[model samples]
Target chain A: MDSRRLFSGSFSLKNIHPSVLITAVFLVAYPSFATDFFIFQIGAYSLILGTIALSLMMLAGYGGMVSLAQLTVAGLAAYLMAILGDNSMGVMGLGWPWWLTVIVSVLGAALFSTFIGAVSVRTEGIYTIMITLAVAVAFFYFVRQNYVLFNGFTGFAGVEPPTLFGVYWRDPVPFYYLSLVVAVGFFAAVSYCARSTFGLGLQAIRDNPRRMRALGYNVTLHRIVAYFFSGIVAGVGGVLLVWFNGRVSPGTVGVDVAIDILVIAVVGGMRHPIGPFLGAIAFVLLENFAIDLIDRERFNMVIGAAFLLVVLFSPDGLLGLWNRVRDRLRFRGNAQLSAERVNKDDPASSGSLEKS
Target chain B: MRNFIERHTFWAIVLLLVVVLFLWMIFAVWPDWLVEAFGRKKTFVNTLLNGVTLGGLYFLVASGFTLIFGLMRNVNLAHGSMYLLGAYIGYEVADRTGNWFLGLAVAFLAVAISGVLLQVLIFRRMANDDLRQTLVTIGISIIAADAMLAIWTGTTYQFSPPDWLFGAADLPIISVIKSSGAAVYIKYPVFRLVVLAIAVAVGIGLWIFLNRTRIGMMIRAGVNDREMLAATGVNVQLVFVLVFAIGAGLAGFAGVIGGTALSVAPGEDIRYLLASLVVVIVGGLGSITGAAVGALIIGLAEQFGLAYFPTYGVVLTFLIMVVVLAVRPQGLMGGRG
Candidate 1:
């Protein structure tokens, strides 16, 4: 029950590395067998969602901050791209190149996120969630009405994907591959960051901000950096989303979708990198297949039920369930071997004890 | 002087910007008739009345939200669902009974029971964890929405008051303007008047309950420090159940009133939930006074924005929220711990 014992006992490589490798392999190979529509619709969409959820997981799991506005940050990036890109022809138009717009959008989202983080990181737990949620609501309304800048309720369309290697880039296969590459890159980067000193500092803050502050760590700065990192990941996902949908609407960043990202992160298991992908897969599959099985109108009922069940039974998520099963099997084998060793070491002593 | 300057700085800047923006907008949409309209005292009174009527409905919805937050710190994401449920149930009841009053009563009771059952069964178990509570409530909301969708489809449903309550009344002061070019018309709905009266009564009742009663005192205590209440041997779980139920019931009542004001639609549950959230955030969570103030601000802004600046109507609420949070993160009334 001691803190040191708990920390030592919780540490395990078998639960972490194998799962990550398996997930990476599955993700890399998923697009190969998927149909063109499936690749674009399910595969690409899942990756975009996974990436967003991963950002949330990084903040919530490591930094102990459950932000409900990650989607808003992503939405901001998308809105920025739509407003700043070459297609914008109305008032507030800035006919910037796609690359330049993309960079600006990402940076804008990061800066906005940093500002939000600065205000929110001072609060703990539920208050932080509410603050970010308020921000999301504010932004949703802002975009819905600001026609000059965000194209108002009827958001910008005709946002063509950037061409790469003579391909239209709108093709499902290519887009899927593009999403895969980006997701992989982000996954690697976030995983690397998680193992770094900065990540450790965030974890330390999560555990005991007061203690970490006493130890001379800039708690606020570290929290802000974490938010910036999370924003970057979400912003990239936003770019991919706009490209995938070929349009950006206010509904894309509404409270429901914001909450969905939290659900996906929680469902995937927030503790590890691969959890988001796993969660995304579960969500995408359920969304695609559940609607087919049930009436389309009642599909949400099914999803809601699944969400409640998952939260109540598996708080660590699907990944945690997998790890537990693996651990149990390993323990069983070890228990049998240890019993055999005991028998061999003292056969006479064991027989007498058994008779007694 | 330093404290005074700092305290007034944000508001002063906002006021200056608002005035400049207003003047610019007025100039851009310059109409010769504006001078006459602005000169009329009756028109000004009507506009103020419009704002008050709208504020009443907002207060009705937001009161429940603030109460739940104040009592249990658990954000009932599905509060809107209860509202939706109330409207739908009210509509169905009215259709069957052919009596609007009875239908309203049935809707209120139905929603109140649903709230109580949800608290006793689902929310009671999830009270310890906020995230889990949110997730589960979201699930419940989604399921409820889907259920409503499957049953009613995406079609909008309307509710009407009795035939006797459908006419407009002429006021003596405004009657003078009727003869002139400025006809200050006041078309009133009996349902709206009833809603306003009920909202005020409920507000007063809630104030008394929270301030006067033992259970209400327990709820207030629980809201401030739930752990401390638990340590005092009070059954915190029971208090939470009651609070959640009462909150849900309030939302349901608002739903019936709101449905009469607007049409009950499938996706509107989330929209109204967002609206209520804005009210709570702006007014400050867990404070009824905050909810009332937040609602009035939002309602007035929404009404005025839609009336004069339709393009900016949606952004107006958000702009208010952002400005409010920027200036007073605790909200206008300030949160209770």
Candidate 2:
């Protein structure tokens, strides 16, 4: 609300939002401070997943469309990249340039998602979830069986990151930076777009599409566009995911993985752009380290537990919890606290607190 | 012909075609390819039996989900967890006491009690909110699944039914096909037939209870308009709890039967859950008749797909789900919610 004072900060959390400064610091000098290769690699993978989850958040948060097919779209992008680009696997790799492959993959993903959106957009709530989930399941099975197009269950291997400017992009630091930059760029783009008129209209439509339709907005078209944008974001993430793993397989785009994407989005904050990233970091950390704590097969229990706890207790996710604590602290410490102020400023009073 | 046409409608026509194609595929097309492995007549009979039995299993699971959803509009993703739990309980009971029937009884009671607890503790607090209830159930399902895995391990397990009820029984089937008018004895699993009978009995009982009983009237009224029913001084919470318990009990019972027929493992929960979803979606949510038709179609499609197009075994069911959702989210049974 206070644009002038919003960004003004002298090493104080009170003045400037922490994300910008933290992001900038990570962007410029992440390699020097955190030189551990595996950490960066993990960060890169998390950022890719975070970006994918962020795309889910874009639809679920703003558009009120909870799609379980975001991962499928990402998988489609990755599959296209593998098919189009050079791969060691004995499949029909068109062997196109990486940039061209990226373009085609992202575009193809958008088209595929728009089609999915067209089919599912008519339904509301649980039906939409069911339709999207069914699509994900169908895609998973289709890829697993379609030998010519998807190379069957084995999938394509050796989808390494392309070298550019005489630099091997697959290196830990470089890959991390690439993923981080992409993730941050998309995150910023979403944040900015969410504040714009189109984004406001979308949020309004999400709340009451029928009302918006009565007001003369093309509800279905707006929904299709939302899916398209979400698809682009997911497509970028997919290309990154494939490059990061150096392979594409059915396991990567599995039903469990698709559900895990929802877990990540839900465990982050479905309402905030940054929520996915927060959830992703937590998820990636547990995925990497939690294996030491238990057998690999039971790790799902941990992830599921995390997902449940977040959804049950704090549906807004970790970010929501932080905001709640911060708000309480603000009230207690700022000396502007009063019963009347509480009544006036409480989000629940104004109906901003979404009843999860 | 007029009465048939009147009752059949467009869906009936489509249903007839599907049945014809299903029979035709097995009787005509399959003989050419699979005769070498599975004799044509045997394969046809086996696939039909498999589809019908699988339909019974799906009906048991989907009916409970339909009831819950119709009443509360809550999608209980944990329904499958209850199935897995029931299977494990049955396995343990049969292993200890060696009474399969007792194991089933105990499993049903235990799961029903747990379902009641789930309704009271979690679902009740959610204020009938879809997302909240869905999320909470997902959590409980996770916890239940993990607990089951921890206790029983990841290995698939099945409890043996009574020796008399188990194994194949030869039954004479008189076919009019090929104008033979001859009777052929087919060896079909007796246990499976029993399971189907049980499913039918449950379905009939559910229907009768819903239509003829006082509680059934309340349930129908409650499902139609929860607020109005509650405002009229009926105990809606009690109905919710009973429905949840019955649904959970049915799922648990189905688990035992399904486990006996096929086997229960870590992912069985999700598989049955997916089956129930397909059933409810295709059958039209909240409608028992829809659930039955949905289950039959899915069962037949699944079994047929597995036999013929092995690569895309479950794809047919998911395809049906997607198509139905696309064409009519209301489903074949015209479920209201």
Q: Which regions of candidate 2 deviate over 4 angstroms? A: A1-19, A145-148, A151-153, A291-298, A335-356, B1-39, B174-185, B335-337
lDDT of 1 by residue, A184-298 (tens): 8888777777667898788778877889999999998999999998999999999888888888888998877887888798888877777788798888888888876877666
| Residue pairs in clash, model 2 | none
lDDT of 2 by residue, A179-271 (tens): 988998898788777766777788878877879999999988988999999999999999999999999999999877998898888888876
Which has the greatest TM-score?
2
Local error of candidate 1 at residue B300 (angstroms): 1.6
Worst 10 residues of 2 chain B by lDDT: B174-183
Model 2 agreement with the true structure over B137-243: per-residue lDDT tens digits: 76777777778888898887867788999878876652223436554556789988988898899999999989999999999998789999999999899999999
Highest lDDT against the true fold, candidate: 2
**How does chain B score by TM in each prediction?**
0.83, 0.89
lDDT of 1 at B335: 55
Native contacts retained by model 1, as a fraction?
0.50
lDDT tens string, model 1, B95-175? 888888787788878888888887788767755677667667777887788788888888999887687665555543332
